[model samples]
Target: MTHIDSATAGPVSGAVRGDGLDARLVVERGSFRLDVALTAAPGDVVALLGPNGAGKTTALRALAGLTPLTGGHLRLDGDSLDRTPPESRPVGVVFQDYLLFPHLSALDNVAFGPRCQGASKADARAQAAQWLDRMGLADHAGARPRRLSGGQAQRVALARALATRPRLLLLDEPLAALDARTRLDVRAQLRRHLTEFEAVAVLVTHDPLDAMVLADRLVVIEHGRIVQEGAPSDIARHPRTDYIAQLVGLNLYKGRAEGHAVRLDAGPAITTTEDLTGPAFVAFPPGAVTLYRDRPTGSSARNLWRCEVAGLETHGDQIRADLTGELPLAADLTTVAAAELDLQPGATVWATVKAAQTHAYPA
Candidate 1:
């Protein structure tokens, strides 16, 4: 119960740290190093969120002693944990792939942790059964990892990690393997379970939606350093990094505003809603755009630009196009629409956004 507390049940910020998992992590390997500090309270689900190679995984690995630290310290419930080995650390890790034994049934996998912690086999199985039931996996106890679905396997993984009764629980991209449909269901269930846990739980993910939905607070890292950290809602409202802004699907532009419109140094001039007279940030959602390869004769969209298609990636049934020219921006278009337009990299295109779609605020 040291990692999170019931007193913080109302509302709290990222500044809220408890007498649970306190970490000053510094791990160096050649040019790559991770220097980060954070704390998570009992029942507090803190997410380590960032893009790939942003040191999110490195930070988690360092805390569990899976990776050696060149310097810094870690403590759990006020006890120093500098020299603790991975096995000895009071930590339970649920890897992204679950890492469940394929041959063992769900019951055996959940029991393995407690058994390793010196509980009798019968006692371990008993405790494991209880954990499985709590995870809503009682019916799947006899199912093997291969037999279970991704969401079911994840629940088993959680039950196994929690069975050890570790003070600090760690999960790395726990729901990344599931399909979007399954992810939503699993994330809601996981949130409920995390809320009930009376200890610190830290989860790592690159998906902004997962981090926002699953954790009380977020600590974002990039290039081995903490870039931004705050409550999910706060960080979403005020993202300091362009990366964070882009991840949240905002059309962020660093430009100067003379009147109602702002001119992006890289590409386009946008008519904004905010009345600014100097340098400002103009942001719009990707959904706000209406695209046409040819310039419109009399379109309502006031902000128009000539851009070249840079790339395209699939998001569900939609194709997200990356454009370059007046400005580099990502646009979400349906796959059928993209095919109909004959869109490809290096193709010239015209993009437009309504003034209402353009939101301008102080930088």
Candidate 2:
């Protein structure tokens, strides 16, 4: 495997030079084809989010020149790196496992990158010391990978990547290895470091919280293509696909809209506040759904469906019930309510949602 290191190389193509990162990554393996176009300005942190087998890793590998692109182009800081070797490209990667050499101390590990780039041993060590100090790991400089904590090792890895002064930085699940308590502290610290970075940073992560917290913009990929891209707030408010909706914790349905009603493709019609024609999407938060053991007569809710509890799980102090029936959806209720309703798999219930709670947008 080619490790990320700094190298001086000329542009391989006559393509117009552009600032930051501009690339259309295309990779083909067997029947899987990944085609993703990514552009980021200097100092921008973009997060690539997707489910398993969604090609998130493939796209990251393509950008780092680890997985060769069968098509598309790669450019960074006005230089075309389409044909640049992995060791020759000015790209730095912080792998999921941190990938620190067990035999090297934290300081030596950080210095390794600059040393490989031909910096003098003294200069490389000096630079590494500064980075360790910046990462607040100066106290652990002499510690080996086994001695450092998860968060400390992650910072060391990041310091090592940044030591090369690469124009494009790639972080693969940088916080995935940390424990919940450690992840909270490290995530905030990582955000600060990313903000101070002057180069383009691309992070691939499966955790929605990681993406929403660390990235300035989010690019959601599904089955090898970008399903949606936008600010975290915007994407959270309006999701275009089921994958995105689920990620943001919203119940989404696609249908044809006529006035205040949308006839869903899944054999149901939803009432929304928006009036429109043609294909549309209606979405509501799981909390907006109310479940009842017996159907209530003369309820004010505009939408009601007979549903059966498919499963139940605890979601942040609330009981999240997955229902399958008239309209497959999820509902969040207090534990007390769950106990009162006797919610369990195979239990029949009535689900209700007020029209005001549903938002509809053009598809």
Task: Write candidate 2's Cα lDDT for 1-363 as tens digits.
Answer: 111111111122222349888788778788787878788888889888888888888888888898998887888987999899999999999999999999999999999999999999999999999999999999999999999999999999999999999999999999999999999999999999999999899999989999999998888887787777778888898899988999999999999999999999877999989998999999999999998889989789999999999999999999999999999999999999999998889999999999999999999
How far off is residue 165 in model 1, in Å?
A: 1.9
Give candidate 1's whole-model lDDT. Answer: 0.83
TM-score, per-candidate, Cα-based: 0.83, 0.94
Q: Local error of candidate 1 at 341, Å? A: 5.9
Those runs of model 1 whose alpha carbons end farther than 4 Å from true positions after fitting are: 1-18, 179-181, 256-263, 276-280, 300-302, 311-314, 334-348
User: Candidate 1 — worst ten consecutive residues by lDDT sum?
Assistant: 1-10
Model 2 misplacement above 4 A: 1-17
- Considering every candidate listed, which one attains the maximal TM-score? 2
* Predictions in order: lDDT: 0.83, 0.89
List model 1 lDDT by residue over 13-92, tens digit each: 33244478777878777777677887776778888877778888878888788887787778888888889889998899
